[model samples]
Target chain A: MNESAISIKDAALDYPRKKKGVGLLREFITGRFKKIPRKDRWFRALNGINLEVKRGEVVGIMGPNGSGKSTLLRVIAGIYAPDEGSVEVEGRITLLAGIGTGFNQDLTGRENIKLTGSIFGFDSNSISDMEEGIIDFSGIREFIDDPIRTYSAGMRARLGFAIISNLEPDILLLDEVMSVGDYEFRKKSRARIDELVQGDATVVIVSHSKSILQSMCDKVYGIHNGEIVTDGEPDSAFEFYESEKE
Target chain B: MGVSENKVLRRDGKLPFLSAPVKIMQNLYNYRQLLKHFIGRDLKVRYHNSILGYGWSVLEPLALTVTFYILFAILSDSEDPYRPLTILLGILAWSLFAKTFSNGTTCIQRNSSLIQRVYFPREIFLFSKSGYNMFHFILSLLVIIPLLINYELMPTQQLILLPIALIMILMLGTGLAFFTSILQTKARDVEHIVTIGLRISFYLSPVFYPLEMITGGRIPEQYAEAYLIANPMATYITMIRSAFTGAPLDIPTMNLVITFATTIAIFWIGSIYFMRKERKAVKFI
Candidate 1:
């Protein structure tokens, strides 16, 4: 009963750097004769990292660019398999990264809702049940039938957020998506997220916005160079983060 | 509250060979809804802005059939009345393999955005590619029915082999795709190499000519069995044509068995290769 909602222990992932000017033909001819060292070929995006977020806990991850924040989130979401260690999670996880992560641009907003809903493992009937709520929340009912490509960036973000939020995911992973859309939409999205958090859903947010981290997170971790620099109250994490920046 | 079971994500260890395909099939079944949506999206997006839409699927093979018909008519003195129908079937069958090979190679890279953002069985993209092309293949097959009627040919027992042949072609194409899609993500050149390989295979396959040209004494008769077994596409295309024309299958029973086994082996090997390489390959993509 005390099990954490998300547990990542000693997780490490390497991003393979592409070989320059290496074609399959050249590799076929020379591969037998050549022995390229594998050690220098990969850029490790996530180092040996351990994290635990208890059930109903709201956690924030703050880091600079290339600090492996998104990669860590992806590992937790099971989008990337770590080169070492493991990630275990309880409950249905939903990750909303940017404007439209899984959207088909050619599909209308309405169609994308169904498609994305299905991707999240929802049956069509449940997707249909949430369809109206999502459209109303997005506030783009007039353009829901138009192809999503026709929507503005804010509109697309609103639609993406609406679809995911209405699904009521048990574990929600947000990767810098809260900064999207205009002031009003952002306020509405924040309210909805607060409501979800109040319902005891586990939440993880990856962001550089200090205001967001302070307001939404119960605890914040500062990551630098694929390693956690601070794991404490938001003020200390931001203090370490700001010092690292200097 | 009860402790819910935790789902773990880690680097997969080597899977036992027998369980690999079964595990993949189970994963696919679990994601069947997404697969359906993907296939539907593939079909809809393909024909979205085009004027002729689905007609384009039939037109390409029909145009090829005509070109071959006119060329062979001028060159050869004897005419096989089933030449046009046979040629159309060959083109349709070959295109299924060719399109799947070419498209499936790039499918992973094409959907990199989706792949990076979401976590689902990556095989869905490859399967959806083949599934949608299979849809086109079936649609184009319907066009040949009128031609079959024009030739006064009705359904026969041999037609049972039609589905078998089609599935074999699909497995072969999907198997090849599974290998190339992962490789293509690592190196952009794999798709180009596949394109060249497919071009050579088109001339080597019996797309324009009858299988008889090869088996009917073009090569020594003894090696013909080996050739059919070696090149399952030849056996499949020949089976498809025979299925429609009701010509007795010229292939020996043993060769058919070996070819079927080879197709399954390729599919199995491809799935295993895909599952193994996919995690590493996505990093490069």
Candidate 2:
């Protein structure tokens, strides 16, 4: 309904922690009687952050480890609700977080394609239509009938990327997924990702690689200690990130 | 862009408890395919590496029936033509309830990887296990029913109640499953506790022996009603057995009335408890 694909105002999310020396049994027994034990600590993963991403934009989030990069993505993906504020999003979003995150190892590549496609909301007819293309793009047509356990890690990544990129998601969320497959497939995947982003689709990518962010993102946000320290063009964000590293 | 910090937390983002039934139904409709995938995956994984595969479904309960059949025969010092059939029916009913709760307890933990990655409703895991066990339970029935027909153990009039009894048992089992599954996420000991409870429950229910053994001579007449009413499994077992063996329903009408009420009540409470706890339980798991 709105041109902005994602809008967040003062959104905050906390990871709860149980107090030390309190056994799980005590917690369970007390919880059964409607007595919730007080949380000893609340780690703020995302804190008082405000941002907006417009339609058809590739925004990259560069942050150090444990700096809330993944948590921000999860909050936007509706996996975790913000504790302090609200997030409003429009469009169908698909998140590719890791290599083969949802695949069943015992299922064959072809069957897994069907499973993954259906989970992403594709009907049977569409899955059948995209099956051959996914296999062809992965270049593992010969091994498509074998169980996914037999595939190498790079091969699984190939298949995962092939299926995800083919789904034509409205908003694509990528979390350091470019560092996958061999040299050749990685180059091919980069080109494929470029093609996907070139469409009228908004993309939010999280990567630590400055070169990738500089080459791909229109705007880059540099985060440190759970706060956005730099929000500007890619070159300036990368400079801020480098300056922070020193 | 101008932005203001909102102080009041809007709990309106989530649907209220009264809409739980409608929410469950809508989720079932929207993620019907995902549910199917989960069931299909669980079934395939269970049978894929096993030597006997589907045979185990029938053989498991059948083996347990044989053990009890022999134990009862030796202990009671009597020969009954329909003894094995009666015991088989009891085991079938009890196993369905036992397996659903036991498996349902670990459904969330088993799928923790998927839970961490995706954003689907967590109850899908519990229902998947319950649905898969139900399929196996129904398949085992295919084996038992033929033996029943061949032996001519059919109680024609009471046969109408079997479907109703089976549905009630399913509701009760799933309800307990929802409650325990949420608890199990927080404390791993819930599974062990449930396993022990089901074992004790099996003996308390009328599995190997008929209700007559308990009500006739084993206990005082005054305490019989309370005993039977306390264990809803006993009522379900009797209902199922009477459907085939023409045995008289020993429990009172009040007990049956209470059993039905408790069955529905447990399901309602279980679903509400699961829906509320599941969204937050993922973090603990």
Candidate 3:
């Protein structure tokens, strides 16, 4: 009955690192990403969060490190589900796994371009059509046919960002990836964000950069200790977040 | 608390990629390409500094095959001239299986840096091993061609089934791999134990010799048969040998049932455990 497209209720996240005691035999039975042994040692990455985002809205979450800022983003991305509470999400969510995640070091730049395009949901045939645009946007025309590993991280990031930007998702999540590369390129990334914002897309950005969130976010919440300490104006949230800093 | 407010704007800007969860699977489907990229990366990285490069894939198995052949051909007291062929079947299957399983065992742990932060599906990484291992397996097949020619063995219509046979090995590998990748990542020593386990299994599995070789001419027939069918890797090697020898596989129709059921069960348990562990895998790294 709720009209909100995304909702989280009392969501909490805990992660286990390492622990001793489980008999030598049972340890191998556990999954690497599970929280079986860290019962006492687990870090409460995200405490509890209550949120609702409707269609055609943009929300920003900002906080200090370990304040569940990135944890919140990861939970929403379905990378982590809350230990408790229900997370009901409607519509499409686009989670960027970074620029280099979908690229190959061994494959030629041409091959990497196609590979990246495919990860954006386009088929090889479709990628071939967009080949020229990818090369142009990346601005590494000469290296387009070379293996991507030979390219610098900047070049790789540019190529990666270029591929995803073309896919056009209904909702987009960014995790400080835009902060990479040069100032000129960051400006380009911001401009691209503007393009997505103007459309029907809903957006969520996680960052420690107050100025950037203040300038671009319509509403921002300061998340601390796994709960929303303050929610409302980005200026006020940032102010509250900064004042609370010890 | 609700996004329904029309004047919700707090005079702040917006967030980045608002719909990441909804896009997880969508991105993953798109990730088939990404998976290929990773597989390509692994293969290239493995061969990077080597002289023969990927030719090593073919060469390694070939050399092992030769060592086994020479020992059985001229050195063994057994009069069976077919001993060379038998050893070839065993070594090829064993090495590939051991290499794939052990490599996959560390697939996630080695990449923990990326695993802890990234929002991509973890299974895709487990699946990436499948891709890379299979690629290497295919490259190794190049050796089979020359070996076949030297033996004067003609290609058979049954060779079309080779792809199917290899898929079975991978499916079996996937079950062990998917399970072990998660298990070892959670428990560090699991990989070390599995490394030794594979070594012992190489000697125990039907790879270096037929199941019949293990049971003397005096052992009960059905019991040895049962062990071959039950030992996880045993059937895999048997089927592989069947591929080359053109034998009937002698597996019960129900054997496929067992393989199918175990495949699903291992994959199901492994995925559940991995997903359960997904949140924590990040913390360790």
Candidate 4:
């Protein structure tokens, strides 16, 4: 019970920069036959990051564009293996990034719920059990049966948020999803997230919105140039973040 | 407290070679529901708007069979009565391999959005593509039933080879898919090369002809066994055709054994290659 929900130690991830035309082709062919020394090719996305999230904690990650905030979440979610160091997580974890992640435009909103649910490893019976709740929460009843391509951006985001929130993983990773939808929808989602956080779910929210982080996060980490520049209470973290911005 | 129960990921952590397959099977079993959803989505998205729906699955191979049948009839003096049946079987089996390979290679890139945001077994995408094509192959096989009835061919014990041939083809196709899907993410040219390779392999394979054309005299008798061992698809298609036409499985025992062993080797090697490159491949995509 005392164990942290998520822990990382000195994790680093690097992505290769883009190469055009002949150089890429040569690299590709050589890469197949031999391990061409690629030390110079990689751009470090996460640099020696160390983080720990206690159970029932609400953590916020604030960073500028290209500052490795998303990559850090992905590593915790197990979508990317760090190039160095280690990561450990207890309990089930789910990362919901962007609106309508993996929605088939041709499928109706009702069907896409089941599809996305299964993508999270939920069985049919459980997904079916949660179907009505998701639909009710999204409040897109009339358009639920219509293909998602016909739904507006806000409607798609609403449906997407509804499905993930209902699943209720032990650890939730949110990346800029709260920035979408209308003001009313945002308030509703914020309340729903509060309920989960209060019920002892570990939450990690990555956003550029300073006020949202300050109000919601128990602790905020400000990342700059793929490294944490500040890790403290929201006020101090924001102070460092604002100074860096100027 | 119970660190053993927690999931730990390290850069150098890898399951031993002997246990890798067991671990993969366990992972696949746990995510069976996701695999089912993926396969269902593939089927729906493919035939959703088509007028004929699943009927097109049968029609495509049938049309190809007729075209090949006519061309062969004009090109040669052979009056083989089971020509159409064998061609259809070959086309169906070959399409399963071709579609699985070509689609499997690009599956990672095609599903890059889901791959980036979600964390399920990436192998599910490749299997779903194979399963979708396998479903079409089975549907198309139903077209051969009437041909069998017309020819007065009864279901023989040889029909048992059908599933055996299927597993071999699936193993080879899915195996190659596992390897290439990762590579294709890094180099887009892999797909183009696979396309041209499949086109040439169609003629090299016994899709529109019988194995007799090679074993009889076209290929030197010394290299006949070597040919079968080199191209496992030739043996697989021949097994499928013989199962339907009740033609004797003329493949030698040693040749069959070697081809089956080679097929398994390809599957194993491809899987290992995929596992090693998978983490790196995702970054490139």
Model 3, span A1-246: residue lDDT tens = 346756778777776534333324455445445655656667777776888877677788888777777768767755565677667665545665455554556777777666555444455577777788867776778888777778899988888777666656656777764654788877887687778766787778787788767766778988878788876678788897788785
TM, chain A, every candidate: 0.88, 0.87, 0.81, 0.86
Compared with the true structure, model 4 gives a TM-score of 0.92
Stretches of candidate 3 off by over 4 Å are: A1-5, A17-39, A90-92, A95-102, A164-166, B1-54, B111-121, B146-168, B218-230, B247-285
Q: Which stretches in model 4 have alpha-carbon errors above 4 Å? A: A19-27, A30-37, B1-12, B15-18, B47-51
- Tens-digit lDDT string for candidate 1 (B32-88): 887888898878887776658777867889999999999999997755879999899
Candidate number achieving the greatest lDDT relative to the actual structure: 1
As a whole number from 0 to 100, the lDDT of residue A222 in candidate 3 is 86
- The CAPRI quality class of candidate 1 comes to acceptable
The per-model DockQ list reads 0.44, 0.26, 0.16, 0.45
Cα RMSD of all models vs. native, in order, equals 3.0, 5.1, 7.4, 3.2
Q: What CAPRI-style quality would you assign to candidate 3?
A: incorrect
**Candidate 3 chain A weakest lDDT stretch, 10 residues:** A17-26
Off by over 4 Å in 2: A18-39, A229-236, B1-12, B46-52, B77-81, B246-248
Model 1 spans > 4 angstroms off: A19-34, A231-235, B1-16, B47-51
**Worst-scoring 10-residue span by lDDT in model 1 chain A:** A16-25
For each prediction in turn, the share of the native Cα contacts (below 8 Å between chains A and B) that it retains comes to 0.43, 0.16, 0.14, 0.46
Residue B71 miss distance in model 1 (angstroms): 0.9
* Candidate 4 lDDT, A135-240, residue by residue in tens: 9999999999999999998899899889888887878888874655888888889888778766778899898889778778899998988887776578777887
Candidate 4 local lDDT, residue B127: 80
